[model samples]
Target: MSTQTQTETFVLHNRASPEPVVHEPAQEPEPELSPKWRYPKVLSAGMSFFVAGVNDGSLGSLIPYVIRSYGIGTDMVAVIAKRYGTTFAGWLVAALSNSTICQYLDLGPILAVGAALQILAHVLRTWMPPFGLYVVTFFLASLGQAYNDTHANTFVSSLRGAHRWLGFIHAMYMAGCLVSPFVATAVASANQDSQWALFYLFPLGLGVANLALLGVSFWDRMALAPKRRRHVAGMSGGVAAESSGKSALMEITVTLRTPGVWLLSLFFFFFLGATITAGGWMVEYLVNIRNGNVKDMGYVPAGFYGGGFLGRLILAEPTHRLGERRMIFIYAMLCVGLQLVFWLVPNIITEAVAVSLLGFFSGPFFATGISVGSKIFAPELRSSAIAFVFVLGQIGGSIFPALTGIIASRVGVQVLQPMLVGLLGAAGVSWLVLPKDAGLHRD
Candidate 1:
């Protein structure tokens, strides 16, 4: 079929209502992943998240090790922060390219490319490459994550009961986080002579499995096809290419024009900043200030991730029922309160429990935001809008941690508390700032 025919069919299928597609008055209910074939695809998406969780989660536990082994920081943590700063470039590249790539590529091939890049990154890290190479791996891994996660989110949100599925996949990510500390800490601490970098081997193996699952599940759609000939309205050759380029550019323009997208992106921005900062630096803080053993403190982050796992599993339905706006703000405030407890209560056990509860409360923020954004944005723009949102979240995810490293290099790791309090409060306020309900976007 011609590109115009495809565009027209999209309109016919999607233009049924002026209101949001989720609430169609007197129409049939939204389709769930009733097709038996889709089960494996969802599983692949979850595995992809799990693989990412392993890659991202292990970094927190390994930070101390990465520092000591490489002599990254002596009096200050500048080198580590500089390393995280590189991840921003990867996410930026993905944000700038996502919409154009989506216009030209099929889903399966995009996912495949992402999976492959991640695997290559892990492979590069397995041998304990140089410091520069180690930092470069973050860029490759992050770029892969951007492609895989943005598309997976876009695909899953398009399904029925997206909240449940989004929670499931994200929870799987927490599960990976939960498990990674044990593995990473174990590998890094097996003996006094333990090679900290060897912990990457585990994710390398998992990345391989993830790629295999993606290839098998997405076999039918997997491809990097040649560009299509555009014959629409007598367009030919360079003119067709120019028109395609123009239309692709317009998608990004429309997504940017929507106020809801930026509002939603703000929520993710602060939410991720707090999360990555907490997870990435919690162990370092414990060791530096609390005088906790590095080995034991490494495992402490598991409590936070495990709480997040259970929270996403348990709270998804309740949040959906209680209302996204009201409940998310409450959860964000709860997170702030828990963060205070974690910060002020000097006891190690108290800090652990508080961080765990904080994770529990913040768990739904990601899936909930995706659910709302999926509904608010037009179907055509969902992929681009969410890609933009995900990138912004990542920008926070990278920035705050790097910033913390920069500040902590001088003042001390104790700065984590106030930074987190401010971020959590900001996140709560941002939630309140969003439209009170998803239904408001109908039309």
Candidate 2:
């Protein structure tokens, strides 16, 4: 009953029991290490941009050829232009659908939907429907393209090294653009009436392929990139505060309030409109105003898209290194000079080279805006912020392309030369409005 007697007996009972209760060091879970190569998802999403390039660029090549088959005047052919504008505008209004649906539905599936719609659009166009039916199908197709574009851009912004991804993805778009002219032109050369349908063959194949790739790549796509915590403002002074609520509306509100956002919007507004208008109409302009043949006009648009593709590839590094703002100024200046060349030059050789250079340099401006927006906005609100900015560019793409049709209808597509000059000039001026370091955020 003594304390020593009881303690000694108890110690002996379990002293050799259970293998001496091995003293193992507690294992700490390995720190969740990010992959050495960051942002493979953003790169995966860049494929969509390649799809877009094929769509836009090929369409430009087919426009004149389609005109001959439809037996429509410049004014009537202008309906196609109008539909593109409306489609983009509709998507702009519907931009929120992406973020909303993405919260539940997988983003990869949504991209598949877009590719499917685009393929459907091409099929419908290939069938050579009556004028009315043609317009309707194109609209449906464009809606899908818009969805893919908005979602891909938003998705890329969430990844690490979003700027590089943004540039590369957009460059792929230019690459598609570069190829479209050649593809459509070649097809048109072979078959006159329904030859435009041939252009769809490539897009259809690619779309399906891309959809399959998206399925395989979804796992990697869903992984979150490293992000810093958001800083909240408080009444006590500048200090860390509790996290703020997030929503598409809140993101839009925050982005809209920033002067940089609006200014960037305006910059895109003019540049996007100008680029789409110029590239879309350039072939028709050459055919109608300059008496160039369909094949030759086809080559002309290629110049622009070719330049654009190169610009995207080459400018990515320099722009990132030299600073986006400075690079933008240089691009704008180059665009202005190129537009002048297009306007003043009498020979096709001069005009072709100039247009290509113009497209090449101006390509950077749009990609730059997306990259900057990704940096300026918080990751939580990124989808909405990018959607807001993209809508502005879509509006520009819609409006200006339509305007080119109207102007080309009456005053002449030749007038586009001067208008492009003015628009590029305006974009240049607006680029300066962005405060230096506006796009730099250490996320």
lDDT (Cα, 0-100) at 426 in candidate 2: 86
Candidate 1, residues 1-443, lDDT tens digits: the string is 00000011122244332112211222432333326657788899999999988888888888887788777762333333333556767777887787667545667778888888899899988887888888888888888988998888777665555667788888988989999999999999998976878888898898989989998887755643223222344766687668667866887788788998889888878888889889889999999999999999999999999999888888887787776677888888898899989888899999999988888888888887887777676676777788888877776776777788878887888998999999999988987787664363222
State model 2's lDDT.
0.64
Q: Which candidate comes out best when scored by lDDT?
A: 1
Residue pairs with clashing backbones, model 2: 303-356, 307-360, 308-360
Worst 10 residues of 2 by lDDT: 1-10
Q: Give the TM-score of candidate 2.
A: 0.81
Predictions in order: lDDT: 0.76, 0.64
Model 1 regions more than 4 Å off: 1-34, 74-83, 224-240, 437-443
Q: What TM-score would candidate 1 get against the native?
A: 0.89
RMSD of each: 6.2, 15.6
